[model samples]
Target: MNIDKITRTNPENMPAPVGQYTHITRIPRNAELFVTSGQIGADHNGLFPESLNEQVTNTFNNIKTVLESERLDAEHIIKVNVWATEKIDWDFLYAEWGQLFSTDYPAMTIGYITALGLPEIKIEIELWAAKV
Candidate 1:
């Protein structure tokens, strides 16, 4: 018997995801689960950058660090959630993000709003990854 994958998705007739993620995800009953805390734009020394692009880069780097600990790479990510204090520069974000993944891009959702935990921080990104 083949086990079905659990995925969360809106109606195909509905509009596509606005940002980086689908409202749904698919998982196997026996799949290994990995949960990452919301990653902020802080460095090892707790340094927060002022520039939006810098913060986005650092945020991705922070996620990479977490993924590396599990012997996983960016391509392994299946779902992602991003939060930003202001509107993101998708072009800038893509420029930096494109350097990490080759072809397989993960499902993602990016939310832009007013504030984050730290005032200096402009963005926070979290992700879920699994081997397909």
Candidate 2:
């Protein structure tokens, strides 16, 4: 299996996702899988931004850096899981999602929690990708 063989779908009977993501993703067996640890809005120096929007942005940037380190891009991503300590800015998140994925959305879930790893960390993201 390869990146081109990955399947993304939204069944007609099911309600659409509230954000920029597909309802399901199917990755073929035998594909190489890459999974990342949950990433927070911190830089290499362990500094985090105060704003939720900036935190979310930094979180995604960190995810990107991890993926690139493994020679993978957004297109190889099959699933994403996000955790946030505050209410999400759907518009801002969707805009950033578009920048990274365009129309090739992946299976995703976002959850609001009371707290994260640290008090200053507003958002965290983890993802799975595949390649042949």
Candidate 3:
């Protein structure tokens, strides 16, 4: 199956979405659409870790878990958005990102902010993936 018409644009250029979502995605009507809830730095046991690196790692792992549940993988992802409580350590996040995604990196957005739901939690990631 082919994913149709995936598009991303600067918010300044388009009408903003009605909710927390940032963009309007247009795709083939027949293609299945997958939406994932915000994945935080929580483990399978629903525990949030204290370290930033550990939190980021768990966030990505949680994303992977959701993708796997839909019979998808990182390669199938088309877009990604990340929210972090602290200023992101670019080097660290990039290194961790390399472990999950090879050269086929998806469209990504990352925001560094003051806080998250829990003070100890460091990151939240959500993404869109489509089948090839």
The model with the greatest lDDT is 2
Better of 1 and 2 by TM-score: 2
Candidate 2 — worst ten consecutive residues by lDDT sum? 1-10
What does candidate 3's lDDT look like per residue over 71-109, in tens digits? 987656767888888777777777778877775466667
| Each model's backbone clash number | 6, 0, 0
CA RMSD of all predictions: 3.1, 2.1, 6.0
Model 2 stretches with alpha carbons more than 4 Å out? 1-4
lDDT of each: 0.76, 0.88, 0.72
RMSD after Cα superposition, model 3:
6.0
For candidate 1, lDDT tens digit of each residue in 57-102? 8888888889989998865677778899888899998876787766
Whole-model lDDT, model 1: 0.76
Ranking of models by TM-score: 2, 1, 3
Clashing pairs in 3: none
Q: What is the lDDT of residue 115 in candidate 1?
A: 86
Q: Count clashing residue pairs in model 3.
A: 0
Candidate 2 per-residue lDDT over residues 1-132, each given as its tens digit: 454478899999999887789998988887899999998999778899899998878888888899989999888899999999999898998877877897989999889999987899999999999985
